[model samples]
Target: MSRNTFRQASLALSIATGLAALSLGAQAQVQEHSQAQRASAFSKAQGHIESFRGRSLSDADHSFEARDLVVDEDGAEHARFDRRYKGLKVLGGDLIVHSGRQGALQSLRQTLNRQLQIDTSPKLRAAEANRIALQQHGGELLSKQPELMIYARGDLPALAWDVRSFQTKADGTPSEMHIIVDAQNGRVLEAWDDIHTAAANGTGKTLYSGNVLLTTNSVSGGYELRDPSRGNTYTINMANRTSGGSILKDSDNSWGNNATSDSTSAATDAQFGTAVTWDYYKNVHGRMGIANDGKGAYNRVHYSRNYNNAYWSDSCFCMTYGDGDGTSLRPLVSLDVAGHEMTHGVTSRTANLTYSGESGGLNEATSDIFGTMVEFYAANANDSGDYLIGEKIMIGRSFMRSMIKPSADGASADCWYAGVGNLDVHYSSGVANHLFFILAEGTNSPLGASPTCVAGNTRVATGNASLSGIGRTAAAKIWYRALTTKMTSATNYAGARAATLAAAAELTATLGSDYSAQVAAAWSAVGVN
Candidate 1:
């Protein structure tokens, strides 16, 4: 999804033979490509592949198989292809070729090393690898089968075993982590968490937002609190359980009381927030649903006894909100909170930004940005739109994070610095949050009683005069395009800068003024340059 332009070059075919073969398994079906498709693919991909590797792609030495052909709304086509060498899957060898409207090559993204040489034969047995993975994860084994595959880590490709096992942390949190063990020397290469949970610490006062419309269904017993318009989204009461929450049944569609004593009141807010978030994306960004697949996600309220946080899980395709300790915070079903959590689902489906490092920072900021946008779109009288995050939850605290001045939260940085990516994702998100505020409301400008660009947060001056906003509409559109079309898993602050600039260029193609310049100026204002 980056804007790295690829140059066309003539490619020559060369032959290389005698290599270990791969156990195709279920992926064998995708390896077959028709002659017509192969020719068309090669014609469009040759230039991109050569440009990315800075060498000619030999058909005899490598095999290219088309996996997915997608044409976006802008008429920009993206073709994903898998690479093979000597009948063996090139491990992480995958490339995405982007073509312009006229079918001309635009750019390419490759995950494999151009020159790969490694022994594919495993020395350690699969049983030993599984035992090692079990010891590392937890001592419990969930599945007995282990998959033997080539594990590629940046330029180093090695024969490895991918082992999966169940684990419970010291805090009693259930999880599953994939441990990649080197088959050659039996060394652990890497490990990653596969479990997705909305980790808030513990739900109900009254309905936070006032009376709002909800789409419900007429069931056999009574009207069910389900949204028919927005992917049939529904809310259930967990009754303080970790799983298997019961569906709430109401005699009438009207739910919630103005006060916390009623359990249904909290659900009123969760359901309303989901509906508003859905409308915001559809009405403003032309997105169909969370996954852009026209399907709704369910919500589980009252999750766990005294749980204090809310989260969106892609694994469950649902959102879970916790009832806060009544003395500290209210239910986590506030409008902005719902928007923030659901945005995680959107990020998961789109860029799938890695949940650590600089990309993780961007991932969190994306949620905050859209969450704020959803609030603005809602514009409810009781809970008006503002840049303040978690405003309703922290009761007396007023707000959690401020988009106008991210460092106001004490831990967040207002500007970027060297090694800034090493900070926590929540704190590192300040850089992007600051840039977005400047883009939407301008520095030194006042937005709805809240003055823009307060001096409390540390920021590098642009030397240029205060900015004039491109408006939230333009800002959101540019960001969405950058995220969905120009970002990769490893994209960092620099990559984000490039991606946003490219997005602005595409958006303001026919504009007289330079929109990309404003994008760069905003980034520089936050010390990104």
Candidate 2:
């Protein structure tokens, strides 16, 4: 199942009003303390449903299962519970209890509109719902019937069929689409991709990474470049077609000549990139695999004629890349590109940040952040670590986004604003990307090369105070912790700030107050306050 985040209450009224009325240092202290209290409550997570329902949700039915608990830095607690009625799961039925330092009930956040009441029996058959779902995704139907679910779409509850279906693309990249069909009316209420494909490199004298050893399979007649050592991560050639391209075969195990003229060279790069990325996540973060399942995802290179984009599909459980038009771009299989796409799989398995609004921006930024880290981890001479993304993709500029100065991309934002959530997720991601750069390297890095802030065209300092670097290691740890533990599916920038601050508090004991200070500064720099 994809990981999801729950919503939390915003900053208290008094705290929000005090920032403008209070002195600068005092305001920082107050905001820090308030954020700490919230984080503390979020971390403790020991709030009981009885206590929560008693004080805040008095009218709520007590049929609930405690799902998660969190305590903030000030020892406050926030408890999350899912409602179940008559042994059936209540869809969209969730409640959160906020408690003070002494475990006193403070507030509650509830998604249940009212006591649910609806007919459980369906007028439509499961087979009909299944057919409707298959039609919704435009994919071939499978034999299995849809599963019955108690669905609530922000209104009256009803029985629904959670239909699962799959779509195999012309290039053999597969994806699963899930549709929620009304059990009584068979209306398609909601549909989402079970496997997300959104847009990787390597080598044995490969196109990107040079002179690397490869693991292969000795097939019936020839050798295939399929690795058995690292979760069977292999590569195939799409043969410039949309579907059903045969796998590239080699007489000898040796592959590639560091050029795209030979398809094997591109495949070599894909294989090497996958290996390095897998090793980086495993060795550095100690994550067993993308999903922590020890299984490997494959790569499909040369997808379609002059296809400029690449995407990672969860349904196919692999990364698909396109060869550029040979003029504006080359193959999409660059090292950082591989890291970026694979991180999408990791995101899907973890927080599963919703692909809309601020959460969507966070999702994109997480991929960029981890992708950059992966590049840094590799430290390959062919593709050196840098803040620039897809530098090897384009011919002239050699960059997709610059984390240090996101505004340099022209479309990306440098700071948060009132309508930022409305911007494209790729552009909205600039805020977090800027914050990451400032946090890891600082405003004026020790190397004397740091990004300058801008309010449109005017230059400005990043935050209220001069910031210091916490280094990438500490910053990555805090981010990983927050993404995995503190964040949910619907978490936004405000929630992200809370989560990161909570992570900072947890890190203080081990990494020192300096690290925490820099984290706060970085967020403040990006106008997160």
Candidate 3:
């Protein structure tokens, strides 16, 4: 609900047609306009329409069929002709005139466009708009709790545009209606609605709650889980930590190093990124905050100017974003960035791997794995995406990080080897990214897996640890369990192997019975064993 403002604005004048040009005839009209009985009836009707623009009319009041009506000095308009839909808000009343829809609608669009100063008609009606807003809004919800914003979306489906909005429903998830609305005009131009149609024969719900978001804390921006007893394993806390300062401050007592950077845009990026990501995670994932136990984490965005990267500092338990060159080449602080950065939080919560050598590689891999998953789930427009990373924040459409082809980044490797962890954290991430990519998707033999890693084991540690390929989906599931259930402080590749096996074992217990062979096979495919 929004407050109504009473302001005097002139209504665009239009000449009345036929009887609209005549004087009042009915006694009701004459009695109301006793002093102006000789005036044109159209003039009386216009006055009635103008009277109720900004003010609310009684549900029983049926006055005139106000059309092309403009608000008067009181900023109110009254609609009494259509009592059938009078109680309906926003779309209520008989203001709709189909005959003049073309001109009036076009003019209304023009009016709103001029008022909001926006073009391309992205006004909640465009397909991409829904995507971006979701990235910014829903994505934030999810960062806090993966289960909160439980993604009912798949690799996002293309949105179809309607008259005032883009509308459509995704393929798999029966929980949501993909929609963008022109808030100004109360029109839906783009929509992926989940409302089941008797004819289309569909049934589903869009979200747990469409209007409200639950926060864990009373903190100005923090959000809590809606249901504390859900399958959450941690109490997740979300802080709009958009800078090193904020990140350092957020997790003062947490068990992680603070990733520090001096980038200027880092703070801003982090702030927005954190808000949206946390919300996305919280709403979609249905978990508490990042830790899932309701512990609040801080975020810091703009640390320094001209800085070109973003990172999650485990030591500090905070996330930071950077401004990369003038083009905003910063790494991880976008909707996907937030999702990726915080997935590190999720990984840390679950995996707790060391940030160096094999463990460090595992940590990086964990971030990329969930990060990509979050992106697919979000289905946002500003970042409606692929498995690519840093698409918008970095080099235009190019991905700064790629699990399928780590070499594409010229920094990360596509597959893990015995000594791959010896590299820097950024580079060490290549192996896990590769592992995740394969785990989520599949082998490169299909030609779509970006074959830049043609060098094979050349990027691996100097060992004969050659790896085959495990399908991406199986790999991701195994890793998710490993990080969330069995990982410990002394985590290493061997530890990861053991923990993941245990996680796999535990998963199999609930799922069926046997996953030992598959888990072992997956690890070998990533060259882990």
Give each model a TM-score.
0.77, 0.69, 0.45
130 Cα displacement, candidate 2 (Å): 13
Every candidate's lDDT? 0.68, 0.68, 0.41
> Candidate 2's C-alpha lDDT?
0.68
lDDT of 2 by residue, 1-529 (tens): 1112212111111210121112224434544664555455544443455544543333343366555444455665656656665555655555566667797776665545566665667788988888777776778655476667676533576778778777766534455666878888888876655443332111276877677766565565566666544555678888887666656667666788888777888888787778777777765665645775556788889988777667887767888888877776788888888888898888776666655568778888998898898888767778878888788887766477878777777777778877887777777888888888888888776533445453443322353345777888888878876776566556778879888987787667656664666677788777777
Candidate 3, 312-375: lDDT as tens digits: 5555565544434555353345556666777777755543444545656666667666666666
Per-residue lDDT tens digits of candidate 1, residues 197-247?
333320112376676655565566566666554566778998878888866
Query: What would the TM-score be for candidate 2 when compared with the true structure?
Result: 0.69
Comparing candidate 2 with candidate 3, which one achieves the higher TM-score? 2
Clashes of each: 11, 36, 127
How many steric clashes does model 1 contain? Answer: 11
